[model samples]
Target: MNNTVPEDGEQLRAAVRERYSRSVGPLLANQPNSANSCCSSDCCTPPSTQDVRDTTSTDCCSTDCCSTSQADPITGDLYNAAELGTLPIAAVLASRGCGNPTALAELKEGEKVLDLGSGGGIDVLLSARRVGPGGFAYGLDMTDDMLAIAERNRQEAGIQNVQFLKGIIEDIPLPNDSIDVIISNCVINLAADKGQVLREAQRVLVPGGRFAVSDIIFQGQIPPALRSDLESWAGCIAGALEENVYRQLLQQAGFTDIEVEVTRRYTLEEIAAGGARASIAVLNEEERRQTEGKFVSAFIRARKPAKQV
Candidate 1:
């Protein structure tokens, strides 16, 4: 795999840790409390469009796709319990995902699962319940604050079958071929070395074990100017890889049946305005138009092909 860890990788990692640590706990808590309220995108307005024609769904394209979107803090159907739901909301508030991992993972009862960058324990809690008493779920993340939040959530939810570990997705802290499924959400792009991340994911999964994730993927090349802007990169736009690159990376990592399904596409305006805060909105008119409708969020699925020949 290419060693593309930018010289700024360490700095970027620090920035990410600091940023998410401060805001994530509160953000997850607010998700269910403010169901219809504008998510992170409510903070900024996207650029006005003057194109001849428009062609994207408002649901598929957030007005400000560049910003972080709050997750459904409650584990799927689990927090519905009147007693559990009434507990201090931390358990329900640990999710930071774009798509529902439980739904895509197709997890079976008693199957082992691993969640990469499992923030706030949202997906882990849900997965644990899905696997029932026989299955187990493990969450791995590098941020101490995130792990703390997740641990709190796990305790609050009384989910004994799940385990939280401190680790990077690019260098997982688990035994190889031990997990039956892997899931992640909107976290992979934040890595400076996605190639290493995928390889690590492949290394940890059992044969035929599933890999399902939701993340941002560029439809084509992002201009050089946009690529280097750290704010844009951290906001999940500039650092995105092209769709083909996603496929190639997974294939190269020994994953099979790679699928890069575009769940939603974001126009340039959408991404720039995503978190409702964009440092890139300063671009000129032509530059703005050049990038319209160029990015997407996808539900990617692949498998560690059942013990290759």
Candidate 2:
């Protein structure tokens, strides 16, 4: 609940890790039909920025994006009932992603795949099925609780083609040119250094490997005052890159044919109604006006071209 943003990379990483680790318990306890209730009518209204400035800590996730209970609208609707039927209920409950990367990754049989920030292994399990027995899927996550749950889900599913590794997305553990496809679900925006994450992704991919992910992107400029708040970063708001900047980052990472397709656009009203309401509610009327219709969840696609002869 600390209001101040972490000043250094290590601090930022620790804060994010702590937040996600704490979220696991609530996610497990959430019911199938539950929606994010963090900012519902029953909850208390958000305090003004000046009032919060005097407070020592603020639960940014509960107030903003960290809460992933059944009430969380952002994590739901990404999976179909048929897909949900194939995995443990716990896996489906643990999903905190914004999009279904496996559905769009175009995974082929016998292709090796990697998922960055593979929270509860839902996408990994789905990818394993798509790749069949001849292929393998690897999931990388930094949180021990999430990894444990993911492994438990993997066991429950009785799948043999998937393995979950412990690591940060910015510094992937895999070797270079070893993977055919890289996918992530709403995780890159959480990284302290997105450029490094992209670079690591590029380094691990074999030439011709595809980069497919779902993430939050901004279409217009966020108010400078809003952009500087670290609390918003942890909530998946402050960290989102502008659409063009996202493309340039991919280009800089040696990716070709970058495409960002919007899957869901968030309005200020929608945010105000969701788990992140407390965060958005703190904005003044003018700031609220600036943010409307600017943020979107997108499916980003790019490719590492074939190696030169």
Candidate 3:
């Protein structure tokens, strides 16, 4: 079946908002998940050539998409036990990222940090701790419910250095060249206008500031008929860009020293069983050839040029 949601942002954005809010509704209502983790779908690899389920939740949307799901292939156990222990249960449960950018970003004390889709504020809190009280961590999210949960998580953590902002990543509320670093987890792929997002990112980062983030990227061909349908595979994994395209976009946005490191790869299977919409969904043999071996969860790093003097 064909999906038109890609041509627009509001529909996909709304789906993300509603889906993420529901992921934490149980905990927000004082009822924790027995499993202690709610997960988003994995990346869009569609499984191996043998048609076997990869068991990776890496394809489409998730509750957070990047939470601590040990059983999930895409949204694997990203946070270590030590990292998990430090966060409030709500923060841990509300996580929805594909990678741990805060852990990977090499943040220094007193650095100003920003989390793009900072759902539930997992990375923000972690960065706050990493940067210490001398540093400030900011989380930017469009969802009110997610922001509310994040604020509560911040309070519970007692991180006075953190602030949660209500805004979309495409248009950050902060000033240009005001941030020292920017980070995101599996959230960039959700944006409909990726170029605009990158432009905004470049605008906010300070000279020599680092742009370290984790995201989903695709390579190879996706037939028009199935692209959005597969994207409907769910949450943040939707609207992924090709690896090379992502690099080009970064360069065009005036970022330098760009690097994309693959942390996990995702595969998809036919919609025969346990599929979101088995009957209507279509990713047959011809398409699977191009689709398989293409999706990956990556940590993309870049930097704004140092001041020219």
Predicted model with the maximum lDDT: 2
**Candidates' lDDT values, in order?**
0.66, 0.76, 0.72
Worst 10 residues of 1 by lDDT: 44-53
Better of 1 and 3 by TM-score: 3
Q: lDDT per residue, candidate 2, 79-132, as tens digits?
A: 665676688755765677878999999999999999999988989999999999
Worst 10 residues of 2 by lDDT: 38-47
In candidate 1, position 255 carries an lDDT of 90
Better of 2 and 3 by TM-score: 2
Candidate 3 regions with alpha-carbon error over 4 angstroms: 1-6, 33-70, 230-233, 269-281
Candidates ranked by lDDT: 2, 3, 1
Worst 10 residues of 3 by lDDT: 44-53
Summarize candidate 3's per-residue lDDT along 146-191 as a digit string, tens digits.
Answer: 8988999899888899999998888999998999999998788778
Alpha-carbon deviation at 199 in model 2, angstroms: 0.5
lDDT of model 3, residue 223: 48
Highest TM-score: give the candidate number. Answer: 2
